[model samples]
Target: MGRQNRSRKRRDEMNKIKKARYDAKELIRLKKTLGLLDAEGNEIMKDIADVVDIKTAKEIKRDAKTREQQELIYEHQESLEKGQKVKVTNDKTGVEHVFNSKTLKDQYGNYPAWFKKKKTAKRLRKKQHSQTKNFKQAWTTVNVPL
Candidate 1:
């Protein structure tokens, strides 16, 4: 009786692994058939679950981390556009860098010194004020009877 129980448990384990592998294959096929992935993405996804092995788990974890980093970068771009300060702290070096209009790197590895803090509005207002000051208006004093 004991031998039979052990053999049954081993069989169950084998069946579980088979089902898991089949499920992974079916899911990949569905993604491809449904047109849910672009050509490049489909190619990448095809290899995502090549085998239900230990490596698949590691690949999934790495992909998650990469996706999270991408989201952070996008948020930083939006904040920079709105003239907000962005700070970056490197993990290995533990160095903190503050970015502003005066110092910030963009997608093309170019630093734009004039990306923010634009003074055009203030300069225009100053010019208009100066022009108004130069114009002299004549005012005549009139006595009003109450």
Candidate 2:
């Protein structure tokens, strides 16, 4: 009886692992169909890839709201002058907040966080260089005899 119970528990654990793997495969398939996955099966856009069929409609709506807010903040900062007043609106809540550049800086320390740290092409080039160098070093070491 003890051995039978242990086998049943093991079977249940295996079934759970199998189900999780199957679900992951299905998610990958759906992501591919939606063009969220690249040809190499890696996620092209992680944000979109994460919003699979399992995500609730409310979650998608919230994500859209956040993106819209970010865009509004960007536009406001672009058009802002030192003394000019800007009206920022929340599309989701329909609330409008007005602030000049001075006021914004006093309150938030920065206008748009996105514009504060813009990633340059140089940064990407350096990142690529480091990645390739690491890969080459790894390959050479692995192929070398002890």
Task: Write down the lDDT of every candidate, Cα atoms only.
Answer: 0.54, 0.59
Question: Who wins the TM-score comparison?
Answer: 2
Q: Model 2 over residues 87-136: C-alpha lDDT tens digits?
A: 77768879565666543432344454334334544433333433443333
Q: For model 1, how big is the CA root-mean-square deviation?
A: 27.7
For candidate 2, give the lDDT. Answer: 0.59
Say what the RMSD of model 2 is. 18.1
Off by over 4 Å in 2: 1-3, 46-146
TM-score of 2: 0.29
All candidates: TM-score: 0.26, 0.29
Per-candidate clashes, comma-separated:
0, 0
lDDT of 2 at 36: 85
